[model samples]
Target: MDSNKNTAVISVIGKDRVGIIAGVATLLSQNDININDISQTILDGIFTMIMMVDLKDNVIENSDIVEKLNALGEELGVTITIQHTDLFDRMHRI
Candidate 1:
């Protein structure tokens, strides 16, 4: 099996604030999800982050993460979106 087949893409976007990265990282850490790559930036006071994470060791399903992230996003006042890496690629392919 491809090692990255279990990978996922997590996206966060909202007004800049403290603890966005920390919150997401903490959740993933507690769930045994490892971050493979991450890129974040602030644009005109808006915060944007893209994280490529490995779910091979994760104990939860992708739907579970989506729910958890949605709740976290509400608390943090941001929008969180997650998709399997394969699905992401398929949707983005032109």
Candidate 2:
């Protein structure tokens, strides 16, 4: 198995609705990002997803990914955050 140390975490949170997965997955796929792991669920009609994506050798840069993801967020009415594994680990560590 591949290590997730270099992967990025993308979190999406918004009202439950259609096309959330499609929109996010499409952007990642278009950028050649590989989805290492994904988990999603609905809580009180709000949808939330955490995706671990591998972007080691993709055409898109980190800034570009942020821009694209922001665009998707705006379009979907969701709040999206993207973070590097190291930063995320540090921030979320117990």
Candidate 3:
């Protein structure tokens, strides 16, 4: 997943419903971001997804991506969080 470039982990959480994936994927697609890894599932009707995306030279900054994602979240009635890969990994690693 282009180890030499910077990446980020994006997560979305909310009630399960249609277009969750499409909404998020559409934003990413429009921004020219590449999805490195993704997994999603429904737990008791709550939708959750984690995506590792490559952001190097994506025509947008980290903050810009976060802003757009947050907007999408608002429209989709979800909560979204975007974090740098290194920061996320370090913070989550035991």
Candidate 4:
């Protein structure tokens, strides 16, 4: 765990099913990724979840998180994405 706090967003989309949140959360916990905030909902059987995570303590590279999530997405039949909050905020800034 590092001292400098870094932030990122993890987004998930998929057919509504069980264990989606649990699986993702478990992985983050295992990897020492801290969840700062989360929003999740299921609409018309489509599941969507967004997790804002703190990576300050995590030593794993962002690329590793992305790859693991991509593989997890395949296993769970979902689309998973991760992007730094700084870039996300910049892109959406008006």
Clash pairs for candidate 1: none
The TM-score between candidate 3 and the true structure equals: 0.83
Candidate 4 backbone overlaps, count:
0
Q: What is the lDDT, from 0 to 100, of the residue 54 in candidate 1?
A: 90
TM-score of each model, in listed order: 0.84, 0.83, 0.83, 0.84
Please give the TM-score that candidate 1 achieves against the real structure.
Answer: 0.84
Residue-by-residue lDDT tens digits, candidate 4, 1-94? 2223478899999997779899999989888888999999988889999999997755446348888999999999999998777776667775
What candidate 2 gets wrong by more than 4 Å, as runs, is 1-4, 58-62
Query: For every candidate structure, what is the RMSD over all alpha carbons to the true structure, in angstroms?
Result: 2.6, 3.5, 3.1, 3.6
Model 1 CA deviation exceeding 4 Å by range: 1-4, 57-63
lDDT-superior candidate, 1 or 3: 1
9-71: candidate 3 lDDT, tens digit per residue = 889999977898888988888888888999999898889999998886753453487788888
**Residue-pair clashes per candidate, as listed?**
0, 0, 0, 0
Q: Positional deviation of 81 in candidate 1, in angstroms?
A: 1.0
Sort the candidates on lDDT, descending order: 1, 4, 2, 3
The 10-residue segment with the lowest total lDDT in model 2: 55-64
Worst 10 residues of 3 by lDDT: 56-65
Instruction: Give the least accurate 10-residue stretch of model 4, judged by summed lDDT.
Output: 55-64
Error of 3 at 56 (Å): 1.8
- Candidate with top lDDT is 1
